[model samples]
Every structure is written in structure tokens, then in C-alpha cells.
Target: MTATIPLGSRISGERLAVLLGEWRRRGSRHGSTDLAAAVEMYVLDGQLPIGTRLPAERELAAALGVSRTLIGAALDRLREDGIVASRQGAGSWIAGTGARRRDLEIPVTDGIFDLAKAAPSALPGLTAAADAARHDLAAYVTGNGYVTGGLPSLRSRIAERYTARGLPTTEEQVMITGGAYSAFVLCLRMLAGPGDRVLVEQPTYPNALDALRAAHALPVPVALDPGEGWDLAGVEAALRQASPRFAYLMADFQNPTGHRLDAEQRERLGGLLARTRTPVVIDESLVELDYDSDPLDGPPPLASFAGELSLTLGSASKSHWGGLRLGWIRASADLLDRLLSSRFAVDLGAPVFEQLVLAAMLEPAGYAALAQRRQDFRGRRDALAAALGHYCPDWTFTMPSGGLSLWCRLPKPMSTRLAVSAANHGVQLAPGSRFGVHGGMERWLRVPFALPSEHLSEAVRRLSLAVASVRSCAGVPAVNVPVA
Candidate 1:
């Protein structure tokens, strides 16, 4: 499969120059080191993918003006580092192991506790709704089995929720897809073409990066300020400069930082977007997950101020169950239709039974039954924070006012390495750069507090041990250790 790099990918021009310069400064005593650096340069430049066959040792040596021995040694080093592999007659191939995507599963091995995902346990009423939907599914599946815009009832429920939130949306303005991610792609296809810029926040959602890349829209990530919570001014600056086709901003209970844009900032951003005629894709996936603050007194949704240029996405996966695989989008009637038409190329909308189940769960009593999950998450958040304070106090983090994860800024830029180390100690952590734009953001870690309280407490303890191990390995004195 051919992988196309975004037009403005960091793998271009100046960054390439910097990488070559750095390698040049590291004088190769053996020429093999230089050849190893060249292979890395090719990978960094997007010229190689997993399993790409490299030129034969003699061929590469002749091309690079190096000896066959140097090429052989370089290939050996690359193999040892797991960056490449070789076969008897096949020469060497690039191994795309920078990171591997693993299926989401419950952790049960090596006494490990997974704090990697931020999702609540399925609440009480889902099964009842599911059972009710099974009858609906049996009847619904008998008809023409293609679903393009999802079931109408679920779309209506989604639109009603947006209208109730002050977005003035109509059911006709809604379309359903696989999940929030599918909704995002549909929006991208409708609003952006290849090479068109799309705005995202720095240190934002990792999967969104993958989505944007797959959509072929260049992601222009504006920085999010940890001090101010959300970056309203940065949004305005990016809008003025990039003139992106669409901007993906998390206006409520943002994922990693748990920062919600206050009313004033929301209005300001909404107005800025409106004036610039830029479509703002507001992802409110975590809206049902406010913890310390009550949204009853908060300002209206950004869509209220964005008018026709706003697109809203919501999912049952984060708020309900990932297994549900249901998500919806609210946008202008014209835009909604365009997205729906473009979506047929992706997949037949979400499963009919899942839609019925989600719609049933959106009813008043069903949602109330799910509210208990927020309280449960709060307990785990508190437990994890308290454990971290008592154990790994040196690692500074802001207790998120709401949302599933805490964004912790480590004292050093070793988060990826730290995650590998943490896994060795029976815990998994997402490296901060996973949320970063291009190849930035290394001095951070995102820990989810959405697990059971006991599990979260134990995860924090293991995390503390991991930090100690990393610090000992680095020969650094731990500072700012918090006391309970």
C-alpha cells in the first residue's frame, strides 16, 4: 500500500536538513554509522514503510561511496535496533515498529493495570435498551440492509440533544456514521480536499492525527496553553494565518487536559470562526463527563455562536460503551447532505440495532441511570491523584476539573521511553507526543482516571515505581515530590 505524506508534513525540507546536519556532526569512525543514519533519513522522509526491500549491500555501498562491509554493519545495527530486518535472500526491509497499533482489550497479563483508555464501565440500563433494540433489529434487518445516514430515530435524538444545548439544530441537519471518528472523516471529505489545511490543537488526540492523515488534509496544530487551560487566542491566530478549511476544537471537557472553554472564550472563538467563514468542528465527545464543575451554569454551546459554519460530533463510545459503535454529526442542512453523500464511500452507516440501543439510552430515565458513572469516575480520579501525591509527588500534574485523563508534564522529555519502562513495571502509559502535532510534545504523559477506583489506585502506585526507575536510570534527583 502506498502511504502519502501530507503536503506540510514535518518530514519535509528544513527538518530533513537538521537531521542530516546532526548526523554529519556525529563523525562516523566506521562509515557504517553514516550508512545507518542514511537509512533513518529515508524512513524519516517518508520514502520507506514497513517491509520495503532495501538495495543489496554491494549496490548500496556503490551508490553511497561506502564499502560493502560498512553497509553490512549498518544493516546489522538497524536489525539489532528492530528498525529493520533481513532474510537470507531478501536482503533487508524496513520494520515500521515506531509504534504498533494494538487492539483495545482488558489487561489481564503480568499483573498489569491499563490506564491507557479513558472509558467508563457500561451502566445499568444499557442491557434493557439492548434487549429492546434486538426486537427492533430483527424487524429492521429484514428490510433493505444498507444504512448510509444511520437510523432516523437516533439522528433525531442526537439533533434534539444539540437543540436542547442551544445549537438550534434540526433532525434534518444530522447524519450518523461508524463513530465520532467516522463523523470526523465525513466532515473532512465534505469540507476539505487534499492539501487543504485543517486546524487541530497541539498535544491533541492521537487518533485524530491518524484520521486527518488518512483524510489527506494537512493538520495545522495550534498550541494549547496549560496555564490558561484552553488557547482561545491561539485559535484566532491560526484562523487568521492558516485560513484552514475546517478547525477541530474540543470545546467541552477536552480529552487530555480536561479543560473546557469558558463561555467568553467560546463566544469569542465562535465569533472569530464565523467572521472568517471557517467551519469549526466541535467535538463534544466528553460533554457528559464534567466532574468538578456543573454545566448547568456554563455558557451556551459554541455552535450557538458559530451559526451555519459549525459542525458538532458526539459519540456513545466514550460516554456509554465503545462496543456500541454509534456516533452522530450536526451541521448545516446543505453540509449535512454533502457529508451523508460522501459517507457512502466509507461504510454503510452504523448498525441499526446499535442506533436503536443508543436512542433508547438517550431517553431521560436511561441517561439518569448512566449519571452514576460520572460519580464513579470522580472517585477514581481522586484516588489516582491522591496516590500520585503520596508516591510520585515529584511528577507535576494538574488535577483535571473534568474529563477522563490528567495531562502530566514530566520534568524531562523522556515520556516515550518512560512509557516503555512503565510497561515493564506492569502499567501502560500513552506517551505525550502521541497527542502532539507532527513530532513534538515529549515532556508529558496522559493518564486516564476512568478505571475502577481500586484499579486506578494500583495503577498510580505502579506508575510511581516506574518514575523512580526512570529517574534512577537517568541519575537525576527527584524534586517537588508531593506529600499527602
Candidate 2:
């Protein structure tokens, strides 16, 4: 039986207006065309998700301060494009079912440069680690190899790493999963239920948002600034107003923006959530990937402040290698038990060999590998920045202190169009709105620096071409085209 989604029944008028940020392009003749394009972009980017009922035409017109006729014409354009479907009595909804469509994904063929993923390639030592793990795997293969709580040795190593990082944890407090994303889904299931509120930072990791949506949780977004990082005041207000059951945060080297919470901000957040008694799951997957910054000098884990109310999630995907597919949750023993009990419904446990490989990577030698990885990422980041400056000078982005990507702003609010254009030119780009909760941030883009330096240069060149294509279509002058 397909369970019904509890939330996303109807979008508020005010929310719809915010989603249609700066929808009207300069020199655009028709208001209806502009509105239709904006709504199409919103649905394509998964902001106004499929099956989400749009606000009434009258209500939207009032919110947008436009005439109802214009709203009706806009909906008509959307229906013509197959972006929206409407019935006489049931009202209008985004086209197709709420589930994602595979056809929407760009094919991974030759000459395609995919910057959609912020993951790095496997480390130099991965093969050696896998080979070494085979010897260790022999011991586990003698049994059924179906341990629910994960291998004791691997859990101990993960817990010790957490303790070394200042958040004292025990092996019993850790629950292993296939990857950080899996751990996030598990935590969401254990922490929240249908119709429960989950507070999150705006422009967070896209997959995290998908997990929340899949769990049928109502996500309340707090605005996060690329320049200033978290808007603590806004977060505090949301906590006080919504009193959400659970909160999800990326406190260290945040995804896309690479914004880290300072000590004072962490302290303030801790106090607010403590008073509200809201349980938070902090994703620290990129914690060890600090570039110019030193983790030793940075703020302690947010879990250290909230004590039992906070759960810290860590992964080897960023620091070590993505192929490892290893992640763990650091929480109280009671919470760990609950996670373990709930985990069985999904799977028995992660593969035994991969756990051994991860355990080996957590040793002293692995720390040395991490240092090398950090240096490599720093170089790649600098390379990407230099390439973007040379090729797409109009694009603006802060040089990230850490993490694998830069949250860039285009000269115009054409990120969705740019993404489509880039894909046609054999480059896969994640549009700015993909990170946003609603359809805002249309002027922004997430450019990953995890590729090789040469690939980074090539990507920027292709992106420059894509930008020219979009601008030309918009009847805007394309100046300063970089020579490839």
C-alpha cells in the first residue's frame, strides 16, 4: 500500500511569492510568460515538488500583487508545457507523481563533465586497504556475518575517533550504516514521524532534503547566508515559533557553502535548542576536510554542547574515499539501541569487508592519508577559483575555507536556464535552486572543486559557453568570452 504524504498539501500564498523570486526578467514583455517560466523552474528543481498543490490563482495573484487574469494565463502556460496539471474541482498540481523521474537525469556519456556530485575520487591507498581487508574478512566469513550493531572492532575505532575529536563516545553509542546519506535517513526515521516538524538550514544538502521529504516530515527552513553563515536569530525564532521535534544541521564546513559555525554561534544554538528540547542531528561528514582552517582551533562538536539532545554523524566518504561507503552515528547508548532496533527493517547490517577496510583507514596511516587529501583538495579549490575568474569573470563566489564546492552567484537569475544549457553542452550543473528549500537562490550555483585541476579548467570553460548560450537566448550581450 502506498502511504499518503502528510504535508505539502497546499502551498501558502506568501510562500509561493517567495518561491517566485525575481521571476520577471528585464525586457520581458509578458507577465504570464515570466510567471510560467518561474513555476516551471521551481518544479524542475524539485522546490515545488511534483504532486504539491499550487496555491489558488486568486490567492497567488494577491500574493504576487498581479491580476487574477495574469495568474490564470500563467497556469495555462504551465499546463501547456506539461509542467502543471489541473482539474475542474481538485485544483492544480505539479505534473506527474511526487516521485522523482529517472528520465530527468542527464545521461553520463562521453564528454560529459558532471559537477552535480561533490564527491572526490578514491584515494591512492584504497586498493591496498581493500586487499588487506580480505585477510581480515576471512575471520568474519566463518560465521553468518550478519551483525546488527556492526563489527565491534570497527565501531570501537569510530567511537575513539569521536573521542579524540573532543566528543567522548563509546562503541555502544555508534551505529554503522552504508554511507552518510543512509545514516541521515536512519536518523530521520528514528527521530521524526509523519507530520512532525524538522527544522533545517536553507540551502542545505539536497539529498538530506530528499530524505526528509521521503520520511514525510514537514521541513521548516531557517535562512542561511553564504557570506555570514547561519542566521542564528532566524534559527532561534523558528525554534521558538515552531518548536520542531527534530533539527538537522551541517555545522562544520557546510555542504555547498562551506560555512562553519563559530564557537559563539554554536554556544548560542546549543542553548536555544536545549531550552526548546529539540533533538538535532549534526552532519560532520566534511569536518576533517578543512583546507586553510585547522580543526584543532575550530569549535568543538555541537553534540558536546547539547549533550544527549545532539547526535553527531560522521562518514569516511569525504575524508577517506567515497567508495568505502562507511558512516556512523555518535549518540547515547539508548539512542543507539533505538537506531539498531529500527535499522533491521531496512537491512541486517553493512557488508563485513567494507567495515574492515574502514577500520584500517582509521588508523595512524589513515591520518597521514587525510593530510595528503586535504592538501590535494586545497590545490583543486585554488585551481577551480582561478579558472572561474579567468573564464566566467561575472560569476562571484567566496573561496571556500573547506569542503568540496563553491556556492557561486551568477550575474543574473538564470541558474536553471544555465543548467539546462550546460547539460546540452555536455556539462552537468546543479542549479542554485537545487539547494534552496523553495524556488529562491535562482541566481546562485554550486560548483564543485573535487575534480582534477585540468577537469576543473575544462568545466569552467564549458560553463562559460553555457552562460553565453543562456545570455544570447535572453537577448543579452555576451562579453568577455574566455578563449578555450
Candidate 3:
């Protein structure tokens, strides 16, 4: 029931509906033609890259809350204009033979089954914390809103957590930013400039790749096999050959592929980076979400080995709530001072209210809620793994002990096409290609279990339907890759 991979990227009907906001002309009679023309505008505007696959008509109709006939008529118009192409068995795609896959750098709309992000909803008692924070805010109201680095109290709380984990730290070693992404940008702007090589994992965070590109820094990648682990020899080679200005590595629960470096590996990698004198950015946003063991007992932070050479990025986005938009950086005191001095050029400081809210959430007394969150996430992870086993028996993925996603190795390289079909079937996906440096990991996909167990189960059921659609669309012979 699976198909070979397709070259193009896919968009879910729900995501597309969000992108095509207010596409219909008010009081217009010809809805189908108008719909076709709107899609043309998206193509022309480059929202829908060439070779992008469209969802099945039924899916689009459901997403748009329109009749299936309208969707069919719109497709008819699009096909006549050469805006779309389709065969009887193969599903429709944006008209073109081949096009480099384009990831729409956009947010997911609510109500659709969104698996594009690994973010879960706010932790329980967020409202009560905000209420507590309101009382705390009273102390700061008399003074001006801006604070350098971050609120001292929040930094202290974060430092305590880092110390608990293994990285002993004082408040001086940490600086807060708007979010982890902003923290990365602040470090990027500080270190390397245009054309400097930056080392990263092959299928690292997509937005991190986007940030690297935006800064005009060249990203040198080291491939990561989800089943296997980091190839330290290859990393050593890249450090030598690439001579990257700075390297970005996720030692704890690395994104996409939820691979964590064990204590031995961490010591080895830390020693390697320290020897090379290569500065690294260790993203620890998902470090706190480890389900199997206590976060306090996790391996020592990569920075522990690399010393001042490593700048660890911490975030509340995953561990707490993303809406708070609070994350921190841990570096050597000297480096933290330097980053703090230069941060104003980017923005003044993080918000006071959210900082207070997060600080409240992190208080030592709140472990019950935090423990409950991990328990819940672990349950959802198992549910998703079970759903895949039940619905798409051929599809394979390594079960992530912590973090939010399962990095799936498809039965075929149908990641891109499956994404589009999955969208049509009411599930949005983080396609495999979005993660690669050059956009071609068509055989893999990252499915997040951030939703509730029920949602995850239903989402996989829908994914099975999409998988069937993709299989039916494979006109070319399947390219066989060895499976374990």
C-alpha cells in the first residue's frame, strides 16, 4: 500500500487554505474559475513551487468547506491552463516535470491535524502561573520595562536547572533571548559572517538552516542515521576540511532524528571540539522533554566538555509553552558578557511578563505539573508508534524515548508526495526534504506526537489513506533501497 518517492514537495489542503486567504472574490458568480485563478497567483508568487503536488479534490473541498464539484471544476480550469497536470491513476501536481522542492516557511493554522512542528500545547496550570506572575509583575511596574540580558530571577532559575542537569553554572553564564531562534541569530551575528562555513547535522532543524541562509553563512553538514549515531570521524574530517567558523550540534535529543549523545559520546565529542578549538552551538531546547529518565540525570551538557567553546541554547518553546517566547544561552562568562553587549543591536530584551511567567513555571515547587507533562508526552509517543504499526505496517520509524517526533524511514522514498497526499487526507506533515541541506531526503519523514493520543491515532489513520493515494500515483518503477 506504499509507493516510490516523488520529486516534488506536498502541501496539505488545510495549510493551502490558510495560504490562500480571502482568495474568493466577494459576491462573485464564477467561484470555480476564481479558485483556479487564485491558485495561479500562488504559483506565480512562488508560494506553490513548480512540481508541488495538490491534494485530492475531496480533501481540498473539505478543507475549504466547499462542494467537491467546485474543487473538481477548479482543477479542470487549472489543467486546461497548464497550471496543473494529472493522469487517471497518478494524482495532480503543479505542471512541470521536475522542480526543486520548496518548503513554505509558514505557521500552521489551528483545527487541522498539524504535525509540522514538534511543539505541544501549553502545560497545565499556565493560567494560574500567569495569575501568579501578575502579582510578581507589580514589583517591576515602577521601573522601566527594559532589562539587560534578562530578568535576573529567570536567569537564576534557568542556571539552577542547568546545574541540576550537570553543567554547573552561575547566573553570569546565561543570557535570555526572545526565543532559541533569536538566540542563534544573536550568536551567528556575533561570530561568522557572510561565506563562513558553519557545521551542522544533515537533517538538522529546518528553521536553523533558514537562519543560516538568511545570514549568508555556508552550512557544512554531517549526515545522521536515525538508527545509528554520529560519525565522530566524519565530524573531525569536516572540522578540518571545512574549517567552519562555528559548528552547531544538538547533543541532547537532536531534532528530526531524535538521537541523543550518551555520556561517553558526549565526552568524546566535547573533547574533539575542545581539541579543534571549534566553537559550537549546542541546541538543548528538547533536553528537558526526556521521557525515559529524569532530566536532572541526563548526560552532562556538551558545553561541559567544550568549555567556553560551546554556547548552549535553551528554550521554553518545547519544554514549557512556545507562546512565552523565552529561551536562554549558556556560554563562558566572558562570552556571555560579549553576547549581552552586542544583543541590543538585534533587540533590546525579552518581554518582562512572559519572563516572569516562565520563571514562575520553573520554580522548584512545580515539578508535579512538569512530571505530568512528560508522562503525557510519553503516552502520546507510544500511541503514535502503535498507530503506525496498526495502520501502515510497512512504514518504519525508530521510537523516540523523549522529544516529540518519530523520524520515519518510509517503505519507499515517497516523503514529498506523501506529504501532499497526507495533506489532502487531513494531515499536515514535516516532509523529509525540508530537513536536508540541499532538499533531497525523500526516503524519510519526521512525524511529531505533540498532539493528544487520540489525535495522533486518528492522524496516522489519515496518513494511511494518504499512503494509499501516493502508492496509486506511482507510475514509474519503485526504486528499491535495502531495509533492515
Q: Give per-candidate clash totals.
A: 2, 0, 1
In model 3, which runs have C-alpha deviations exceeding 4 angstroms?
1-110, 474-484
lDDT against true structure, model 1: 0.70
Query: Candidate 2 residues 1-484, lDDT tens each?
Result: 3223323335668878976889987443588998987787655444554446678888898999999998999888887766677876677876631212222444456978878878888876777788889899888778998887788999998888778777888889888888888888888988898888888877788788777888888787666665787878667767776778899999998887889888788888988888888999999999988887556556788988875878888888877777778888888998888888899777788889999888887777877888788899999999999999999998888887889888887887677678777877788877665676543456678898888999999989999988898885652111111100
TM-score of each: 0.75, 0.79, 0.77
Better of 2 and 3 by TM-score: 2
Q: Score candidate 2 by lDDT.
A: 0.78
Positional deviation of 291 in candidate 2, in angstroms? 0.8
What is the C-alpha lDDT profile of model 1 across 1-484, one tens digit per residue? Answer: 3333222212222332333444443555756776675656444222332333556776655655557887788888877766666667545666543433233322235667666677667767899998888887877776986767777788788877776666676778888878887788777777888878888876577777777888777787655666566556556766776689999888887777778887888888888899999998888888877776444445678898887989889888878887887788888888877776677687767777788889899898776775677777788788888877787787677777678887777766566557766777787666664675544344667788767778877887877777777765542111111100
Instruction: State, as a TM-score between 0 and 1, how close model 3 is to the true structure.
Output: 0.77
Candidate 1 residue 408 Cα shift, in angstroms, is 1.0
- Please report the TM-score between candidate 2 and the true structure: 0.79
Q: How many backbone clashes does candidate 1 have?
A: 2
* Predicted candidate 3 versus true structure: per-residue lDDT over 345-413, tens digit per residue: 899999999999988888765667888999999999999999999998987877776888988878766
